[model samples]
Target: MPALTDKQKRFVAEYLVDLNATQAAIRAGYSAKTAEQQASRLLRNVQVRAAVEQGQQKTAAKLEVTKERIVEELAKIGFSNMLDYMRAGHDGDPYLDFSELTRDQAAALSEVTVEDFKDGRGEDARDVRRVKFKLHDKKGALVDLAKMLGFMVEKHEVTGKDGGPIQTETRTWREVLRQEKKG
Candidate 1:
C-alpha cells in the first residue's frame, strides 16, 4: 500500500469534514476519477481519522444549535408541540379552521397532546386552543370525537346574511353534522 503525503492527508481530512470523497478529491486538485482512491487512502491514515472525528463532533454541535433555533421559532408562533408545527405545513397556511381539518389533519394535531396536557401540569396559554366535545354517527353511536377532530378546537364568529356580526360563536361545519345524520 502506498503511503499518503502530509499535504494529501490534510486535504483528505478537510474534505472528509463536509464533503464526500468524490467532492473532496475534486476540491483537493485531483481528477474526479481519482477522488474515491484518494478518500480511501486518507481514511486509512490514523491522524486523518482523528481529525475527521473531531470535525464530526463540531458539526453535530452546530446541527443541535440549528434544531434549537427551529424549536424556539415554533414556540414563538404558539406551536406547543412538533405535531402542531408540522401540521401548519399543510396547505402552507398557518391559520386553519378546525372543521377544515380532515381525519389525517386531526391525527397530526393530536400527536402534540402530551400527557402533561391531560394532567393539567402546566399553564395553557398557547395560540392553539383545545376543546372537548362528543361526536355521534347516524345511528347515534358515539364516535371517537377527539380522534376524528384532532386537538384543535375552532370558534368562529357568527355572521348575518348581510355579513353583519351577530355576536355569537359557531362551529365551522354545520354541514358536516347534517351529512353525518343522513349517512
Candidate 2:
C-alpha cells in the first residue's frame, strides 16, 4: 500500500474520534470551503480506507471491544431481573445486596449512590441511609439486542387520515377540473 501523507494520517486519527468525515478533514487542515468534498475524496481512497480500518482494529484491540462481547453485555442488561439483586436483610427489610450482582448486572449498573439522613433530636437520633442503583435502560437494551439478532425491523405503513389503507390512484379536484377542461 502507498504511504499516507502527514495530513492524511491526521485525518484518519480525527475521523475515528466521532467518525465525522468533514470535521476530520477540517481538523486535518483541509480548506473549510472544500472540507466536505475533500473528506469524501479521501474516504474513497483505498490506502485511506485501509489505514482507517487498521486504526479501528488497533483501537478495538487495545480496548478489548468485540461485537459478540457487546451483544452479550446488552443481553445481560436486557434479561436482568431486579429480583436477583433484592434480598432481605437480617431485619427482614428488603434491600439490594450489591455483592450479589452478577457479571451482567455489574455491566448494567450505570450509577450507585448512597445518602444518609439524620432525624429526631440529639437524645434520640435516627440515621437513615439510602442506597440507589441506576441501571441501564433494559428496554433500550432489548431493542438493540433484537436489532442485532435480526429480530427487529422498522415497520412503516402508509396510512390514510384515519389510519386506513392509503387510497392510491385517486385524482385531486385539480385533475378532475383539468380533465373536464380537456374533454
Candidate 3:
C-alpha cells in the first residue's frame, strides 16, 4: 500500500483523539463542506486504516487498558447492590455503613451526601445525621458489558405496516418523461 499523505497522517492522529471521522478530517485541514466524504474515503484507504489501527493499539498500550480490566470495571458497577454499602444498627434502622466496603464495591457509588441538623426545638432538640448515596447506572453498565461479551445483540427489523415486507416504488426515467409529456 502507498504511504499516507501528511493530511492523512494528521487525520489518523486526530481520529485517535475521539474516533470521530468527520471532525478528524476537518482538523486535518480538509474543507468543511467535504470533510464527511473525505473522512469516509480516507478511512476506506488500506494504508490510512492501518495507521488508525496502529494508533489505537499504541494508545491502548500506553493507557494500560485491557479487555479484562474493562469487563471487571463494568462488573463492579453492574453487580453492585445497595445492601453492600448499608447495614442495620442495633435499633433495627438501616444506615449507610461503609466500614467494610471494598474498593470494588465503592466504585459503584456516584454520589454521597451527608447532612447534620437539629431535629427538634428547645429541650427536645436532638442532633440528626442524614446520609444519602447514589449508585452508577447499573443497567447501562450491564448492557455495555453484555454487548462487549457478545451476550447481547441489537436486532432491527424494517417492514411496512403490520410487519409486512417493506413497500418500495421503482420508476423508470423513460416512463416519467412520457408522463411529463402527456401532462
Candidate 4:
C-alpha cells in the first residue's frame, strides 16, 4: 500500500477519536456535503485502514485500557449490594459507617450528603446528623456485565394466537460468575 498523505493521516487519527467516519472527515477538512462520501472512500483504502489500526494499537498501549480492567470494574459495580454499605446496630437501626467502606464500595459511591443539626431546646438538645450516600448505576453496570458475559440474550417465544410459549431460552450469568470466582 502507498503512504498516506498528511490530511489522510489526520483523518485516520480523528476517526479513532469516536469511530465516526463522517465526523472524522469533516474534522480533517473535508467539505460538509461530501464528508460521508470522502470517509467511505478513505475507509476503502487499504493504507488508510492500516494507519487507523496502527493508531488504535498505539492509543490502547498508551492508555493501558485492557479488557480485564474493564470487566473487573464492571463486576465491582454490578455485584455491589446497597446492604453491604449499611450495618444494623444493637438498636436494630441500619446505619452506614463511611470509614468501614471497601475500595470497590468507595468507588461505587456516586453521591454523599451530610446533615448535622441540633434538635430541641438547650436543656433537652440532641445532635441529629444524617449521612446519605448513593451508589453508582447498578442496573447499567449489571446490563453491561451481562452483555460482556454473553447473558443479555433476547429470548423470543413463538406463540400461537393464544400467546402460549412455543420456545424457551436461558442465560447463564450465575454460572459464569461462579466459574469466575472459582477460577
Using TM-score, give the best candidate's number: 3
- Report the lDDT tens digits of candidate 1 across residue range 1-183: 556566676576667567676677667777676678767877777877677776776877867755445434333333223333333646775543355544533433423322222433467544445543222131211122322344445567778768985666565467756865787
| Model 1 steric clash total | 0
lDDT of 3 by residue, 147-170 (tens): 999999999878899999888888
How does each model score on lDDT?
Answer: 0.53, 0.90, 0.93, 0.88
Residue-by-residue lDDT tens digits, candidate 2, 53-145: 999999999999998988999998898877777898789989988785667678878888999999888979999898988878999999999
Q: What is the C-alpha RMSD of each candidate to the true structure, in Å?
A: 28.5, 10.5, 6.3, 15.1
Residue 63, model 1: lDDT of 74
- lDDT-wise, the better of 1 and 3 is 3
What are the runs in model 3 whose C-alpha is more than 4 Å off?
Answer: 120-125, 157-183
lDDT of 1: 0.53
- State every prediction's TM-score relative to the real structure: 0.31, 0.70, 0.78, 0.68
lDDT of 4 by residue, 109-132 (tens): 889999999989978999999899
* Candidate numbers sorted by lDDT from highest down: 3, 2, 4, 1
Task: Compare candidates 2 and 3 on TM-score and give the better one.
Answer: 3
Shift in Å, residue 48, candidate 3: 1.7
**Predicted model with the maximum lDDT:** 3
Residue 143, model 4: lDDT of: 92
Ranking by TM-score: 3, 2, 4, 1
Worst 10 residues of 4 by lDDT: 160-169
Instruction: Give the lDDT of residue 16 in candidate 4.
Output: 96
